[model samples]
Target chain A: MLIDWFTVVAQAINFLILVWLLKRFLYQPILDAIDAREQRIAQTLAEADAKKAAARLERDEFERKNRELDEQRQSMVSRMQDEVSGLRQKLLDDAQSAAERLQTKWHVNLQRQQQRLGEGISRRVQDEVFSITRKTILDLADDDLEASIINVFIGRLRQLDGEALANFVQALTAAEAAVRIRSAFELTDEQQTAIRQVLREIFPADAAVRFDCEPELIAGIELTAGGRRVAWSIEDYLKTLKDSLGDLVREQDSSQGTPTAESESLA
Target chain B: MQLSPDEQVFWQYGFIKLNATIVYTWGLMLVMALGSRFITRQLSTEHTRSRWQNLLEIIVTGIVKQMKEVGLSEPQRYLGFLGTLFLFIAVASLFTIFPGYQPPTGSLSTTAALALCVLVAVPLFGIQEQGVAGYLGSYIKPTILMLPFNLMSEVSRTLALAIRLFGNMMSGAMIVGILLAITPFVFPVVMTLLGLLTGMVQAYIFSILAAVYIAAATQGHQANPDLATNAPKAHSQTNGISHG
Candidate 1:
């Protein structure tokens, strides 16, 4: 067989050209797409990371604001509570002062009323005593010595209970030794004897008697003994003076409807 | 009998047969190698590495990766042998189109010598990676009873590789030659084209089988038992039955 060099060289050249064309058109493009896709993916990942960081920052800010607001609200509530408590204390103080003032006023009024009542009672007692003294001096003006003495004794006996009358009679008997008599007018022995007989009959046997007389007694016999005295005086005829004074006081009390005891005592 | 002068002279010298085939085929193979290298370099220059260099690197890397996957410990030590085997077979097939050339790989003596080199190198590689004791001990695992079968398989495998390459190439060449003598010219053209195709195919088959054999020998007794045990190594050895 003879060698064929031409055909072998031709085939080798054909295969080489085919390989170069396939590499240039096909493989390069596929590799470029792969690199470009990798770059785009990296960029997208970085963008997503940045967004997450921003979201986290915003959330932290919101949490911070929320915490501040909660603290502020707590402080505000506490301040309001303090103010309410202070207001409550003030109101309590005001109420206490008002109560004190009312209590003081009431006490003053009560003390004033008690003082007035005491003064009123004292005045009435003094008036009653004065009237009793006047009546006693007026009773002595009766004309008949024995009759008057008997009448006085009977009246005193009617006013006194049994124990008082006994005390009075005992007092008269004890003073009998000191008996004395005086008169502005001359007295006859028979009249004296008669007065003595009457006194002896009215008094107990051991009773002591004393007598005194003044012309100013106004035609009435006056008798005096120990601390007891009887007089018949023209002053007794002036009983209208006390009656008028009592009527005047009653009229004043009725007209003013009995002024408060404090006002009356002040007057 | 009266003879023509030309016929008498022709009969006296037998026939004028030229043995330019080997020279032409080797030349063609050199051209193919240069062409492959040039095309690869042109494509590779656009990138950081030349394509031929890159392809060479890829082949080395792929073999290494396969070796690692096959669990060989010292792939670099055996890489030269496998790489040479691949290139020789590839170039021989591609250049087989030259009219007078015959690939030395088609000869039994050459293939047997190659297979013997593989057989010898496998144990050496195994022993270098794993001591001699470990290499021998690998046959008996998971049991000692497997040692005999494991040893027999190793020897048979090398024989298979050698016989398969020789028988396939020799038969292809003989069939094409006989066809050419029977019908010259047009028929010879058909046979030549067929021979080219067959030559390339046989080269690829032989190389792949060599890889399988080397892989199995290094990987050990357990490697691909299903295909290795059932498949026939040569055409005459199989009773005219196709395994695939």
Candidate 2:
């Protein structure tokens, strides 16, 4: 009695119509809008992530390049320092070599100068001794030394053996052959006659004789026939004195442990 | 005074009688249609919205959320059918605050029709979700001998849903009418307020029970998804009839 069939059918139809209307107007549009907004948000997040990744990559690359540049700069600076150090060492070696060569040359020059001074002093001493010997002999002779020397020579001619007398006569055989005599002093007439008598004994009586005075011989007599001649002088005694003096100087130098140094020739 | 909307027949043409139930149902439908049309005329997808549009959005969203909380994984799929059912019942109950207003849900015929709609929709949704063979396969579940009992259960549950709403609404109205007769002053007003609260509760209960049956028909979906998904705002049971 409570149920009405017509009303039930009517209400079901009305409910169905309502369902259709709300479906078309309400649910569809709102769901679509929400989905669209969610999709937009997802897209924005994805873009931001990509940009962040790219920026991180760029920053890493730049830092790597900067590190490489810094390393290269350090390497270059080290190389330059090494080069400069090497150059300094080389310059020092060259300077040391040059200084050693200059020292050797300067030492050689000093040696040469010392040797020259020694030679000059030795020559002056030798000349002074020679002059003193000549003056002493001249004062002691009182102008008789030349006559005594002639007389001694004449006597030595008389005592000669046959072979020696024959050699003296053989040298006088040239057509223009002559005898020349030199002495440290002038000869007198008596001394010349005696020298001529001694020569007559060995050569023809017409043989010419020439006489000359040479002070370099010190005090000595000299003889000549063609290119043959004989002489005597005080210079022989002076040479013996010089040899004895040189031996004394060498012995003193050796005892004192002095290194041998070159000396210029007194000659 | 008429005990039911069915007995308050305004136009009777032989076996076919036009009653207060049909008229009021039509009037409620018209009001719903016109209001929706005006509110949805110029909808905007921008941030700003008209007040009516905002109200409609709240209602539609609330219904969709409720349907999802019930069991529908895709709430929008069931929003139209379920939302209309809820709106119709709630509107019928709510308009009672006005003088001389009678709710269509108080009529046994209207409540039966609503239950019939659920009964029809259950198999249709079941067949759509699962094939005809699969849907029919649910009857023989637990044992092959349970097929007749399952069929009986389906018919019995539909009848129960219709009768429950009718009994609750009609009893409230009857109690208020009786109280009006006895005291006729402040007691009737207090009973009317209590009746409104009961009507709203009944509307919510009827729709949720219908959703449970539909969820049962669908199978593989939870009848109350709040348990499975751990949703916080779960609907508490007024009566435990929805356990099926």
Candidate 3:
């Protein structure tokens, strides 16, 4: 068979029609669907990426805030610790000051008690010495001790200074021209006469010596003339010694920063 | 059995003849068109797809991908021509495994018509891409003496394509026919299977050659500038794989 020109023309036209049909119904739609799917996937991925970035930023912010809170908590804790430490120090200082104050008050009270005890002992010693000396003098002396006491009284009158002599003379010149003499025992008449002779010589206007027995005088004598008195008692000397010893004790307590009381009693 | 389906005359008018070649070609075209429409009617882009949808997408994307690999950067622009050429020849050879069917591609007229389409398409695409003067100027390259040589090469290659496809398809059918008389059963079945393999090969070769031609024509198309740079290397692979 030869080449069929009519069939060739027909086949070519058929192929072109087939090409147009396939293009219209097959290739175009599939390609469009594929393109659409690709675009959707890309958009979803972009949204996912944006969400991931936002999550990361939020996480970072949370971490930063947590760190700040931690710092604040630490600062508060440290400040509280410092305050507690300061309070502890103040309490310790208050305790120490209280202990020292109690100690100082106790020491002062102790020193006062000690000074009072020393004063009591000194008084008791003076009283015991006076009693012993008075008893010994009464045992040793008989009639002479009283005479000696009278003689000592008269002697004291004769030894009076210018002011005393005038005072006595002025008193003797008055209507009461007598001097009283006190003794631990009764005086002899001779003793009394001697005292009167001394007085008359000194005063020149009277010679009256009145004698009296006062056993409580404790082997001592006293003269009273013109409303003036002169005494020689062992109690006065004992009081002087007691006062000097008390002053010494007071001075020692003061130098040692102690507190004590000192008293002077008239004898 | 007739060598060309055109020998089967169905009706006639004065110098206007209707033949089996025209009939089968139209019937094949109708089947192709209707099947494609039905398969694409409810297409889905989801992960789950119909088997038919899967098959059609595979064929279409495979064709587009091959063209792209061969340096046709804009593959869909040439998809219609190249894809039709491949399906036509493949379907033609494959239908022969059935009884009472003769391939239209076994005829010289149909093969020549297909070759002529390729010849016409090469220039049309070239002219569209680089303009007429630039495409014509490709011939005068290196010297003016190459103009006739390039022309002769174009015509000669087109004829080679037509005759080569015609002879191979026709000879395979002829050999099976001769074997049918000599040994009726087993050898003919074997040869028929071999023919199927050969037919699929021819389809692949035809599509590849057409792609190669269009790739050369649109070589300087600057839509994808790197495609022009890589085209020659891709063209050499095409040359290596080219058969009728």
Candidate 4:
């Protein structure tokens, strides 16, 4: 069968016209909307990216600050520890030095106290001895018979050696028999000659002598020859003086818990 | 040539024959359209001279500019429609040089169908862009007294486009056919040449009118009244249509 040219022509024209009309109205508006939507989407994506970047930067800054704070705190603690250590060492040194100084002071004080005590004790002993000697000397009288006897004995002392005679006088002054010699003996020539002969035999010639007589003796004759004195006495005054002094020394020694000659002699 | 008995009977039956020349012409027209599309695509390649690209750029730019003048919100949407219409009409005009090939646009039914599609689509688009009320209001625009006239004008313009394209192409085809039948050879050549020029001009006129009508319907008549009025004049001048 032959194709219809008229129908085909009519159809082609209709198709072209329809295509034109559809393009003018429907396609244009849809395309415009798509373009607007695309632009909006792009803008939203860009804004989101910017916000994310800002957040990351803020977090990084916070971390950095935290790290710095930690470092600072550590440094401060270390510094404090160092200072404390230094202070502790200094205190220790100061305490040690103070202890040493106190020890030295204690030692020096102990030595000085010991020396002072020793000196005071020695001075007290010397004062006691001097007081006793003074009391004994005051008891003697100038016109006493013992004084006359001492004067007669001293008059004959020129025949002795000087050193020996002085020693003899010291011994006579200490003797108990000298006191009896003053009262019991009126010197007869023969007795006096006999004492002189004994004195000459005991001492060197051309010596001066000093004699002391005590009346405390009951009866005695005493002759001082050189540095030595011989006494014959009925009284026990020497034994009594020795006994009292020994008792006093023994009492002192017993109180102090020390050994002495008095206690040894008594034992 | 000896005729067989069955062949003779078949010849005597007076059955309608397919016109070889008409088929050849139609085929040539199709080839021309396809070839033009191929050439345009090839010319778009990187190595082609800038002139071809410049030519296409000028055409696209011109269409965009016209759409802008018409005050369409987005002109790019209409590019595909305009490009298709331009290509179709250009290929349709080439039918003039092919003997016995009739342009499809020459038929009244074809033109009327195309016009009807445009008529229906325009109001639909207008209603979609603006509400139905707004679309109706546009018909009565400028003054209420001009409402009936404007409404009639829209229908008449669509009718005019159908009649114009059909009359112009059919007349050219009839003229060339009559000339070929009477003068067998030499005079027919002159008529064919004249037909080519007429066909191309008529095709261009049809396409431009279609573009103007679309621009008016989509953008609204009030958007650019001056441009709407001037578009048809420019079409006539370019196509050498001396409209009295």
Displacement of the residue A207 alpha carbon in candidate 4, Å: 91
TM-score of 1: 0.36
The candidates, ranked best first by DockQ, are: 3, 2, 4, 1
lDDT of 4 at B133: 82
Task: Indicate which candidate wins on lDDT.
Answer: 3
Cα deviation in Å at residue A216, candidate 2? 5.3
TM-score ranking, high to low:
3, 2, 4, 1
Poorest stretch of ten by lDDT in candidate 4 chain A:
A176-185
Taking the candidates in order, what DockQ does each have? 0.02, 0.40, 0.51, 0.06
Model 4 alpha-carbon drift over 4 Å, by segment: A1-267, B1-73, B231-244
What candidate 2 gets wrong by more than 4 Å, as runs, is A1-4, A87-267, B1-76, B86-107, B166-204, B220-238, B241-244
Q: Over the stretch B1-244, how does candidate 4's per-residue lDDT look in tens digits?
A: 1110111121221333223323433454456444434434434222223564455445556656755665555667555555555544555666556654566555565556556755765677677766788778878888999899988978887777677666676676666677767888888788777766776666556656666666666666677686567766765574456232
**Per-candidate interface C-alpha RMSD?**
13.6, 2.0, 1.3, 10.7
Prediction 4 global C-alpha lDDT: 0.56
Candidate 3 CAPRI-style tier: medium
Per-residue lDDT tens digits for candidate 2, residues B134-214, read 778877876789889889978987888898888888887888888888999999889889888888778788777777666
Q: Where's the lowest-lDDT run of ten residues in candidate 2 chain A? A: A258-267
lDDT of 4 by residue, A232-254 (tens): 44334545554565566555544
* Displacement of the residue A219 alpha carbon in candidate 4, Å: 99
Highest DockQ: give the candidate number. 3
RMSD of each: 16.0, 8.8, 7.6, 18.7
Please, what are the lDDT tens digits per residue for candidate 2 over residues A31-108? 555555557667778888898899899999999999999999999999999999999998888887777666556656
